[model samples]
Target: MRFKLSTVVLPSVLLLGSACIVEAPGGTSPEQRRAATVTQIPPLSVRNGANLGRKVELVAATVQPGRLTPGERATVTVYFKVLEALEEDYLIFVHVEDVGGRMERMNVDHKPAGGLLPTSQWKPGETVKDEFSIYIPSNESPKALNIWLGLWDPRTDSRLALTNPDQVRNDGRNRILLAQVPVAQ
Candidate 1:
């Protein structure tokens, strides 16, 4: 029996074509790229991204690709200026909450300046640049998200009170307003 080229080779060719492997654009997979990009700052150190008190002042919060979606991560950069000299080192905390100040997620890290640089070492007029990436959970995802920043002590499990009561949210722990992230498709 003669084998027809179309019948015998077509399917095999198509299968091989489909199975062909394509290297990730730069030879790194999605996860690899994500790892390389990393959250600009480590999660262990966190400080108020805003000026919530005399100790430190939050100068700005910038989110890249402002549009957030479920399961996607975005980079957030928080800028701070030292106000008054700090006596001791402190931990920084970031809260991602719903519209009403109800927290959906929170990140408590060392100072945005990094572990080596603590709040105590920070100098007045100095700038603190902190950045991180957060992956939005599908179940907890909302149309809009709010970010707040503050300081905390892990040993006492207490959050540093903000000098400005006006900036405090529902709990009044003094989570300075970072920004409102609007979710887009």
Candidate 2:
């Protein structure tokens, strides 16, 4: 008895090569295709209320074109209520997550140009509106999106104080609001 390298190698290679060819999953069933393609956006989990100090309370949030074009930009509006005058500097952080796991942050101020404000300066029972526009890159995939809103205390210079070593953990606590927007072709 004798064994040839070519004979064994050739057959094994052919078998493996053929096995690699996979037929596209059946697309005839619309529901099946949708189920396979759809991805659920993660929930925005928050522990503490928006009012960190004593006044500013995030009331509601709304986004225009809740559904966005693949490469288009959209605006998000956040409304807040001031229970008492905000004297110390504070910041509103808006976080956005795309299907590709890319995240971006936008900051808004209590006053249009005054920059981040202190909790004490925000008068009691005052309604404030903050808006931001985010541009979705043309190359992003069409999938579910996640958005989160947070509040932070800024330094005396009205700069966001993000030096906390445990700042990452704050995601769970600072997230006052969450939303999912869709992107389509």
Candidate 3:
């Protein structure tokens, strides 16, 4: 049976003290990114963590109606494109953590559209869109939650490579912290 989309509530955020991230002196140039190996990603199986996600880039990740209440549902939309052809299907991973680094969160792991659309169907250089609803747990009190997004292959339980290693958490799990979701009491 295929793995269903489910929320695994972990006790607390993994607080690895913030590390400084350095960007290009001026800005990202196509020539620079291509040189970094981000513009061309290889298949997941033969991939290396050091390569990061230079090939398939996550363009925009937004939480509609950004604020959430206990037990409420919110829509999350993501826009991304593959700079090169991808040969394997990948999963979307979402993790909601408190801004204070305290309290628990719901981490979601599943395929697109509840196991319908797979990343393998993505065409090179074509932008792909994905949307889904996330239900905030009623058990916890209201707080600001950071919504982190990333891609992983369920078959091997491995996270896709990322480009920036300093600004985000590089747990070797390939997660990218995308946005902040305010939980109102």
Residue 184 displacement (Å), model 1: 2.1
- Kindly list the per-residue Cα lDDT of model 2 for residues 1-185, writing each as its tens digit: 12111111000000000001112332124442332221222132122124544445555555565466656666555555666665554555555565366544333323221223233444565555555565566665546554555555546433322223132223434453345555665
TM-score of each: 0.62, 0.54, 0.63
Candidate 2 differs from the real structure by a C-alpha RMSD in angstroms, to one decimal, of 22.6
lDDT of 2: 0.42
**In model 2, which regions exceed 4 Å deviation?**
1-50, 99-120, 156-171
- What digit string (tens of lDDT, one per residue) describes model 1 on residues 1-185? 11111111000000000111222232334443333232334343333334555777665555555467666666665666777887765677766666555444555354444343556556676666655566666555465666556777777887666665543232455565555566554
- Candidates arranged by lDDT, highest first: 3, 1, 2
State the number of backbone clashes in model 1.
13
- Against the correct fold, how does model 2 do in TM-score? 0.54
What is the TM-score of candidate 3? 0.63
| TM-score pick, better of 1 and 2 | 1
Clashes of 3: 6
lDDT: worst 10-residue window of model 1: 9-18
**Preferred candidate (lDDT higher): 1 or 3:** 3
